[model samples]
Target: MRAVITTEAGGPEVLTLDDVPTPEPKPGQLLIAVVAAGVNRADILQRQGHYPPPPGESDIIGLEVSGYVSAIGAGVTGWRVGERCVALLAGGGYAEYVAVNAGQVTRPPEGIDLVEAAGILEVAATVVSNLDAVRFKAGETFLVHGGTGGIGMFAIQYAKARGATVLTTAGTPEKLDLCRTLGADTALDYHDDWVDGVKEATGGRGVDVILDNMGAKYLTPNVRSLARLGRLVVIGLQGGVKGELNLNTLLGKCATVTATSLRFRPADEKAAIVSRVSDEVWPLIASGRIAIAHQTRFPVDDVRAAHQQLTGGNHVGKVVLTF
Candidate 1:
């Protein structure tokens, strides 16, 4: 099997296609013949040696994929050979084949292309699981930084579908417009004082909830932008890991701050999240309430180009590697 292998921690140039032994299904797992794999910022981090797969998992760079079940392992039932499915994985997606626990697999939403389904699980699982954990309400205002990225775009639409007023941040006008098309009520340019824009959009009341990926860079402003008793969930640290926070402002607003990483969770926990998405969110997708996100494809052999494109931050929505 052909898989993208990194020679060392560095740039996209380090990623090379190499022949590797095919993964076999273990007990209660499935051997998937991967059709496509979703590229993520985490992959870049792993390539740069900032992130690594959980112990005992594959060292492959991908986190999600759409593929067909080639073999079902012992104790796995209700799945047959050759069923089209998508999976959320701890690792091992950037390859021609991957072995995933059966619990992490679900049928892609009807009418969605199998190839594009590669882009679905990671974004959907991240947004849905986090929102559910935070108990985000329908009438509450929601803001997500990096609105053009895969998770951000999905968060915008999913929040809107659940009846929340959605706001997002992007660096470009075209990106902002795309967010609006996907149902963002307000799209603020991150290059500006977007915290002030958040305040202005909410008429100074601040938002009821925020889904931020900027971590420490936005911590203080995110706290300042919260409405009374608002909740802020940090799921990434793209802007840096450490920042000062004003406890007084957070105290005054009676807000709560929490952080999570979907990629580092245990398999059973991932299975639970996968189940929640399949039961609750998949309906939204199948009903077209959650729009099919913008997708960009790169051939698997050109995985280096795919990494470069994602790292360049010029593409909207998710980037996928086709097999």
Candidate 2:
């Protein structure tokens, strides 16, 4: 099997293409002939040696994959060899094949191409789990930072599907337009006074929920933009990690602040997240209520270029590498 091996902890330049042994499924996993794999920020961080795979997991670099099951472990059921599916993985997605846990696998929605399916699991699971954390309700307004990216686009669509009014912040007009196309009722320019824009849009009432990636950079404004009992869920810290949080502000609005990362979660927790996303969000894809926004595709050998695209901050959706 051919794979993009991380020869060392460095830039994308370190990714090397090589023929590696095909990985066989363990007792509780499925060996998938890889079609495509989602490129995530975590993948880039891992390449730089900042994030390592969990204990006993593959040292290879992908977090999610979409392909057909080529072999199944002895105890796996409800799926069979040759079944088209997408799955979350502990690691090893940057290859021609990946062994995925049966419990974390989801049948590809009908009509979704394999490349597009590759963009689903990670973003879907992330958005759904964070949305769950906030207990988002229909008719409520939710604000998402980084609205044109994979997770943001997923959150925008899912929130809209549930009848929530969605708003988002993006640094470019192109990105903001993409967010609007994805169902955000309003898309503010993150480069500007986003808080004022959001406040004006809600007639000074603020939003019920905020999905933020910039973290500390948006912390103060995020606090000021929340309505009573609002929930702010932070999933990325692309800005800065530490900030003087205003507890009084939070208390005054009776809001809540929470943060999470999907890659570091335990297996059972990941399995449960996958199950819930498959059960609740998969139907939307099948029915066209939700769609995968796959913006770019690079061959497995050009993973370095893929990483460059992500780091360039020019992509509007999920970037994928195909086998």
Candidate 3:
């Protein structure tokens, strides 16, 4: 099997396609013949030595994949060889084959091809998990930062589908238009006073739920932009790690803040999330209420190019690597 191997932690140039032993399924796992893999910011961070794979997981740099089951290990039932499925992986997706726990595999939504399905699991799981944690309800206002990215785009569609009035922030006009087309009620320029814009869009009540990716950079402003009893869910730290919080403001608004990550969770927890997404979110996808957006596809051998595209920050949605 040929896999993307990093010679050292640095730039995209370090990623090279090399022959490696094909992974075999372990108990209760499935060996998938990789068809396509989703490129994520986590992969770039891993390549730069900022993020490493979780303990006991593969060192390869991918978090989600779509493919066919080539084999299944003991204790795995109800799934067969040749079944088309997508998986939320902890690692090892940048390869010709990957071994994943059977519980993490899900059937692609009806009418979606395997290549596009590669981008579904990670974004869907991330958005759904955070929204569930915040107890996001219909008829509330939802705001998502980085609205043009994979998770951001899906978050907009998901929130709208659930009956929330959605607002999003993007750096470019093209991205803002795309967000509106995807159902965001308002799209604000991230480089401007987005906090003020969010409040205005919500009729000065502020947003009830916020899906934030810019951690420390937006912490204070995020607090300011929340309505009473609002919830802020932080999932990325592109801005920075440490920031001061205004306890007084939070108390006044009765707001809550939560930070979460999906890759390092326990197996059973990941299984639960995967199961919920398959059951609840898949139907939304099948009905076309939520859609998969693919900005570009690069061959597996050109993994470096894929990484570059993601880091360049110009792509509107997911950058997929095809086998």
TM-score per prediction, in order, is 0.98, 0.96, 0.98
Ordering by lDDT:
3, 1, 2
Candidate 1 backbone clash number: 0
Q: What TM-score does prediction 2 earn?
A: 0.96
Off by over 4 Å in 1: none
The lDDT leader among the candidates is 3
lDDT of 2 by residue, 1-323 (tens): 89888878999899999889998899888999999999998898899998899888888999999999999998988887898999998899999999877888888777888999998899889888888877887899999888878888888999999999899988887888888889999999977898899889999999999988878888889999999999999888878788778999999999999999888788788899999988899899999899878569999878889999988867778899988
Q: What lDDT is obtained when candidate 1 is compared to the true structure?
A: 0.91
All candidates: CA RMSD in angstroms? Answer: 1.0, 1.4, 1.0
| Candidate 2, residue 92: lDDT | 92
Instruction: After superposing candidate 3 on the true structure, give the runs of residues whose Cα lies further than 4 Å from its correct spot.
Output: none
Tell me how many clashing residue pairs each candidate has.
0, 0, 0
lDDT of 1 by residue, 1-323 (tens): 99999879999999999999998899999999999999998999999999989899999889999999999999999999999999999999999999999999999988888987999999899998899888997899999999989999889989999899999999889998999989999999989999899889999999998998889989999999899999999998888999998998988989999999998888898999999888887889889888877888999988988888887868788899999
Which residue runs does candidate 2 get wrong by more than 4 Å?
none
